[model samples]
Target: MTLQIDGLTKRFGGQAVVDGLSIDIAEAEFFAIVGASGCGKSTLLRLIAGLETADAGSIRLHGEPVSGPGLHVPPEGRGFGVVFQSYALWPHLDVRGNVAFPIETAGASRNDAARAADRHLATVALQPFATRRPAELSGGQRQRVALARCLAQGARTILMDEPLANLDPHLRGAMERELLAFHAASGATTLYITHDQREAMAVADRMAVMSAGRFLQVGTPQEIYERPASEEIARFIGQGVVLPVEIAQGTALIAGQRVFLRVLNGAETGPRSAMLRPSDITATDPGAEGAVAGRTLSVLYRGGLWEALVAVEGLAEPLPVHLNRPARAGEAIGLRLTGGWLLPEAAMAAKAPRRAAASAP
Candidate 1:
């Protein structure tokens, strides 16, 4: 399914929960929607699922117009398999009964539905738990059941809303691999939504970063992380600093220091902002190129990556250096800014209920 959303908006009592929003998902693409809570990620999903009415805008599936009262397709008719954060399974139904439910609803005969359910159970490695109800299954087991049910729906497009939220850290990783395997074999267009960056980076073919109620940026995971479209995006992707800068001839002034830039593209101006990610800064000795002397405030060993807070109060902003090698806290150090890219405020979209940006932080 090539899903397209254009200018979708929903308002209640003059408050727009989901403001103007649009996205294009390619066929067989594993697209991801990420943002913070209340950025309307789930609401956008519901609109796609036909669970709520859009106050304005249009949704098209495979280029077919869908929206408005009479024209909207119901969830059951959409050929979508959805697995939610809670794994919404029937407590009364055993695993086989649960997986067969969707097939049964579509007019499959009892024997046919049971066979289909069995096949899907095998696919998700849940055949042994065929007789287990929701309560009898673990979190990951129940999630597999939900996914199996979705597959049995004869669905060509899959939508998941925080499907990994309930799983423990180890289980989350396991499910991610399973999802990719499923997508590779089935080639269904998937739209996975979540607020976790690690999850998004792991599973997404491309990440759409949202803020407020609007999409701030959309690109490959590398593009979103490495060459972010704006300062806000850079901040969201890496631990960094966005400081006010004085732009003059071929150089920008940070604090009282003249820092040169390798400008890629931007507007000419007096005052602008420069974004520097922590990873771009490295500890170097005095007299090294681009080195600035400073005192170390603190050090942290984060997931085997060392980080130092270098205090250069003259720079107005405390710079964070992400060490490529480990170092101790309170150790005097000199650091150099590799200097990140430049972005203008105008380049940033107005903060709408960004379903993607909600996951920015």
Candidate 2:
């Protein structure tokens, strides 16, 4: 492992923001930590970068202790590169100068540093903008410069904190590609933090879903999406609906129809929650096997496909479905569940108190 954290915890005013977190990140692997705002992801990054002192935990990088009890290394001494959301370029220096500055600080001669900077800038395809100052470059270009500076520093580990948050949607897509290219070229261990689950899915080899100072689950994007560990994670990672259901003998009883259930998390015969994604349910012929009658509660055209919510008898919430054509409100429809995951019994039990509290009044 290139980075290993154990028992990591940080607090503010008696509230734990990062509570007993542990993860092993392999060298040159891209790992993403995704969660909503105030989930302690950024603070976790700062701890790894040595910008914030961990109240309790051990941070080991390639067998060296950077952070632990009675030991702390400053950010500069860690030799890791950090990219912030704002890009953090020096206004006074041109692109080439900005990239060269780190090398010069590491004891390279001025002329030697400039030559090395040009080589690094070429890696990011920004050699042509070497003379442009930070103010003269677009947001994307400035971001490349930051990356080039990281290359010039020869950093083997890079930490990025929502680096694309400042860009527009279009640029964000472009930068996502650019970031993958940069990672391939650098081969550095990357720990990326983002609130955007889609972006994390796009760039990460693996991702962790965090909430309220703890990691709820961590796995490949597909694994997390298709087989979420809990109801909270199922709703957070992607579009889906969790409806109450009864399970028996590897099948689920939903809306007066029996459908094969993809049992996950060792859910047994009992009342549980079924997680159905838009793709899991499809329009089928009326009275087909495992088909359930429903009504279109609402529909919206999403470019190429129509997204609709369907209310089925005996189901509490509407299940989301996709259609090839327009759907009308209150129109009768037939839907079949081709596949769905069952939430574990423990997760269903854990949710009972909250559900009870909300219905108490």
Candidate 3:
């Protein structure tokens, strides 16, 4: 029950949008592909769903070829479900009608399709809105309707293309929980695509970070956050300050402080970047040895903590420091880095790698 994509490529106007990508998604695994907008995440999903033809490569499900050079499986014939960002419900259809459409399309009788729709509606807690039209429902309810319609189809693999993007912040949070519960109950292999790193972190069992039509790294959310493969990945995945450093013997001098490395990108080292998350840095006494001192530029209250911008020497940008207590602007403070990741030069290459690294970030 694995989905294997080999040499999957797509292009438009002679420019490659998805370039020679390969990945294996395991059965019932919640895998997410995350990147900035226009990184081709949605395009890849469209290619898999057969909405767009691939210029090259093949896609296999459970060892059966569905897409390749010549063979083409229509979206419905592939026995998969897709939930898009727009909710894509028929304007004239009520909730039950929308949910039953897929089942009915698969050759089920009207009564049987209605029954299956009822079951799926209950799974997503949308049974209460069974008679409401798409226009009559709230954004969250509309999203649930779309999801319920997909579930009613009973596809083993579910592809969601930023389905939560249309919801407000609070509704998005609620939907994320419902989505996870549905995935657990359905036992379906889910491929979620999003530009929101927080959404990817929340929903994925594993995630891939993409840029410029290629995956930079793939790993569990925690693994990617804790030990990013490169400075670019670290910056993309979360809030962090990538600082230049000098390394030797599993140690590095970052911001003038020598700290132990939890992970190193490779053996070769001279000048490299260290990922120092705001959580990894702490305020210290002024003039402390091996500590970097800087003037406070700004202090922002982030609900639970205050994030201060500190100006450090030998750095082109201001360093971000998360503080337990608020500090005044124009004040001075020293910073001590608890620990950090040592990114090798290759991981920092300007171009995508020719081969996937054997590490996760």
Best by lDDT: 2
lDDT of 3 by residue, 40-62 (tens): 99999999988988999999987
Model 2, C-alpha of 130: deviation from truth (Å): 1.5
Q: Score each candidate by Cα lDDT.
A: 0.77, 0.87, 0.84
**Model 1 poorest 10 in a row by lDDT:** 352-361
- The alpha-carbon RMSD values of the candidates against the true structure, listed in the order shown, are 4.1, 6.2, 2.8
Ranking by TM-score: 2, 3, 1
Which lDDT tens digits does candidate 1 get at residues 242-350?
A: 7777777546766445666544454355777777777667678755656677777788887867777778757666788877676666666777665665654553444
Q: Against the correct fold, how does model 3 do in TM-score?
A: 0.91
**Model 2, TM vs. native:** 0.92
* Clash totals in order: 17, 0, 0
Model 2, residue 32: what's the lDDT?
A: 92
Which residues of candidate 1, in runs, are more than 4 Å off? 248-269, 285-290, 324-329, 345-361
